[model samples]
Structure formats: C-alpha cells, structure tokens
Target: MPPATPPSPARRPGYGERRGELVQAAIRVVAAQGIAGLSHRSVAREAGVTHGLVRHHFGTMTSLIAEALDTILPQSLRRNPVSLLLADPGYPEEDLVSWIDEQADLQVFEYEVLLATRHTPELRPLAERLYRGYEDSVRSAFAEHDLPAPADAHVTLILAAIEGLVLHRVTFRRDDGPTITAAFVALREAIRLAVAADGAPST
Candidate 1:
C-alpha cells in the first residue's frame, strides 16, 4: 500500500479582512470560471481561506455574490461615459476602455453577477441600488454634455443596449472596433439630436 499523504493545512480566517478579500476572490472566480462555476469551495480556494469562512463572512452564497457586485460597481462607475467621450478620467489612467481592459476580470465578473441578480430576488435590491448609481452617472454625464438623455424607462433600454454591447464583445473576445465605435457614434448623435430638438443650451 502507498503511504497516506498529509492533508494541506486549513487556511486561516481573514476575520475583518476576509469580507473584502472574499468578495474580490469571488469576483476573480466568476471571471475565471463564470458564475455557474462559483461555489463556496471555489471561492475559498481562490481566496485561500477555509470553506467555513465563506459561510461565516457571508451568510448566504447569494449575499457574497451581491457583495462582489457592490465591490465592482463603484469602480465601473468611477467615471461617466461622457468623461470618456471627452477625455479619459485623467492621471493614473488612460481611458475607460483601458481601465476596462486592465480590470477585465472585474468587468466581466460584474455582468455575471448582474445576470445572477435577474433570478435571485434576495440580491435584486442591492443590484437595483447599484444600478441607480450607474443611472445617476448616466444622467449626470448627459447633463454635463448638454445632451438630452433618456427618461427612466428609456434609460433602462439604453442601459440594456450598452450592457449587450459590452457583453457580446467581451464574451466573444471580438475586436469589432468599427462596430463598437459606430454604436457610440449613434448614441452621441441621438443625444445631440434630442438635445437640439429640446432647444437646450449647450454646455
């Protein structure tokens, strides 16, 4: 008989640090393996923590996923689309696309968690609040550009469009630059036309 190998030492809890660490690890896990592969053990393995710590830090698995979204939402909204349309966020960054490329995992993880929110009722409110923040940025961005933005209902549609664009490209790993550029061009034109029709003064 072969000799029994010793088990690897159990990872120690991060205590307060585990909250943030686990959230980020969960994001990486989802990005690397997709949301379907996310599990307590998977996240623990990614986070280098014992599996029990996942349950300890986050009572429900869904809550951990929700927190991961919460963690990345602010980074996603760090600068409004208008800022990128004008110039990059400035200093310590190049542009939104650059930032997205740099944080590809986080960005991809964001959409995955977003899909999870669609079916997870308990996590939906957190998603809604996070979305409101993005919406606020969208409203502010257009307003700053003196552009007429969509109303709440229409804003939802626009957001869906933007989401689809990013999701499709990111999922396929396609570099359809012209198509993506044209989409933004169309969006800018629409905003400009709407503002013009509204007879709004330009900023």
Candidate 2:
C-alpha cells in the first residue's frame, strides 16, 4: 500500500498582534473593493502577505468579509452613535439627533456591503447576523436607561433609515441627515415615553 501524506496545518492567525494586523488589512480590502472585492488573494495583497497566509488566517472570503465588517462597523457606531448617546446621562435631544445625523452622513462603507449583499447570498446570513447584533446593542443601550423593551418595528425603522440615508448620501450626494435625525428623534421620544410609562425608576 502507498503511504498516506499528513494533512496540512490549519492557517488561523497566531493571535494578539498578528491577528489584529490581519483584520485591519481585511478592513482596508473591504473598504477598497467592497465585500464582493474580498478574495484570499486580494486580501493577501492588501495585507502584504502570501495568499496562502490570508486563507490560513481567515479560511474564506466570507469569513474575512464578515470579520472586516465586525471589526470596523462597530467603531463607527461606538465612536459616534454609542459614545454620543452615552456621553451625557442627560444627552440633550439635539446632541442625540446630531450624532445620528453625523453617523448617517459618514460611513459609506456600509452602503457598499449592503449592495454586495444583494448579489452574494452567502453574505446575506452574515449581514443579518450583523444587523441583529446592532439591534441588540442598541436595545442594551436603551435598557441601561431603564427604558422599556423597544419595539422591534422601531429598531427595524432605525436600521432602514440609516441604510437609506447612506444610500441617498452616496448615490445622489444629497444630505439626509436632518430627515434621519427627525425620524430618530421620534423613535427616541417613543422609547422614553414607554420607559416612563413602564414606571421603572431610573437608576
């Protein structure tokens, strides 16, 4: 009988420094090429690594794209949306609205991913997972304020408005910030009223 060859070692990143570098490279690749532009070879070129290494680190383009979105997307929200929302226990209505307006105007990368999702069915699941994660994150923020369980419809609207604002901003170069702020302000008030009606004493 012929001798069997040993299997190749798995290609996951080593951890700590290298892993973060690999992820950041993937983010740039996504930013440049859109999610559809993500390929092991393309990402490897972007990261200045061997194609085999990129595959080893991320396994597949889908995983790489998902990770890219995961790492970069939240910071856009955390830096702008979440940070502003949490900054003041008494966050003025205008500050809250302006923050949302700013986020909607910035971060065109999300629009790229959303467009890619329409063509790549594999991406849809990852996109859904990411959206759900955002919804949960937003919900947790409201919960911290002793707010009621926010209605799913409102969350959906917020997500849609954000997406629409990005689309309008990128496609027509139009400003949708004020419109987005108006919608968000309405949702915020609804949440606050619901929280007050729930009668949970604010901590």
Candidate 3:
C-alpha cells in the first residue's frame, strides 16, 4: 500500500501561518486580561501550541506585542467606517456597526496597549505608530472625498471623538446598536459639514 504514503508528513502549518496564529493568540490574551497577562506561555496556551514554538517565532514578549499590534492595526483600520467610506462611499453604516460589534475585542486590545504605554516606555513608539495609522487613514479619507485637509488639531480632535465613542461602546457594554449607529452617523455628518465649511469661500 506504498507504506501509507508516509502519513503525509502530518501537514504542519507554514511558518508564516504559525506566526500569525501566535500573534492572534497574543491579541486575544491581551484583550481578555490586558497586557500584564501576556506571556509566551499564555499565548501558547491560547494558540494550543508549545511555548517554545511561540518563542521561536517571536524571540521576546516585546517582539510578540509589536507583531500583534502590527497585525491588528491594519485590521482595525480596514474595518473603520472612515476607511470603509474612503474605499467605497456607499459602504453601509449598518455594516460598519456590525463590524464594530464583531471587533470589540480588538478594540479592547488596542486600548490596553495604548494605556500600557504610560508605564512601558518601550511601547510608546508602537502606540505612536498606531495613532499614526489612524491619522493617515482619516487623512486619506478626507482627501478621497475632496474635503479640505483638516488642520492637525482638527484631525486630532476627530480621532479623539471617534476613539472616545468606540471606548464608550466597548467599555459600557450596554450601549445599544441604534445609539452607537446614530452616534457614528452624526459624527460622519459633522465631519463633512466641518470640512465643507472650512473649504467654502467667505460670503
């Protein structure tokens, strides 16, 4: 019987695939228990892999945290309403709300990391990159829609408002869908009006 075809070598995951799994596990651990709970063993347990395997993929916890942020930042941006609108102006608000609901854990993870930066100076750069990613996405969305480039302060305020809304929704746990959706809709309309007003010629 051809020696049972050598059992097909047990079909191990590709290197990149395994690394990705570890990163996702790290995010989940941080999301559930905050950054203080993240360790090689914790991630290994979360991913159902050996701790050595996690270390092999990421030499240190810092590396693992960085990779987790790197992986999640794009994911968060891609699902962001502003980014979605930039990609497809017709993207539904309902869909955005659904995506937000589904990604609550990811949002929690992000905030955990951002807060951790206060005590972990090494993480400050990663936090800066995270904010820069959001800022770039917002700037791109504004340009894509022909809105005037907002001042740096205005962009910062926009990010603060959106981030605050997301935090309130995820943290409170009781914020209803309609309320969250309405808040997002109002924020988007407000942004458009503000940008248009900035661009309009003085009467």
Residues 1-203, model 2: lDDT tens digits = 98898999888655666657777776666656666676778767877889887777778777766776676556656643432343345355455445444554224455666678888788888777777777887677666655566667766665565455445545554565566557555655554565455556657
lDDT of 1 at 94: 29
Q: What is the C-alpha RMSD of each candidate to the true structure, in Å?
A: 7.6, 10.1, 2.5
- Expressed as tens digits, the lDDT of each residue in 1-203 for candidate 1 is 99999999998655667698898898888899988989899999998879997888887777887777777877776756544553333222224345445677877887776777777777677777888877777677767755566467645655665666566557776676556666666655564554455555547
Residue pairs clashing in model 3 are none
Who is ahead in lDDT, 2 or 3?
3
Among all candidates shown, the one with the greatest lDDT: 3
Local distance difference test, each candidate: 0.70, 0.62, 0.81
- Clashing pairs for model 2 are 11-56
User: Which residue window of length 10 is worst by lDDT in model 1?
Assistant: 86-95
lDDT for 136 (candidate 2): 80
Query: Which portions of model 2 miss their true places by more than 4 Å?
Result: 1-14, 77-109, 166-203
Query: Candidate 1: which stretches are off by over 4 Å?
Result: 1-16, 86-96, 145-150, 198-203
Clashes in model 1: which pairs? none
Error of 2 at 88 (Å): 5.7
Candidate 1: lDDT of 72? 81
Ranking by TM-score: 3, 1, 2
Return the TM-score for each candidate structure: 0.74, 0.64, 0.88
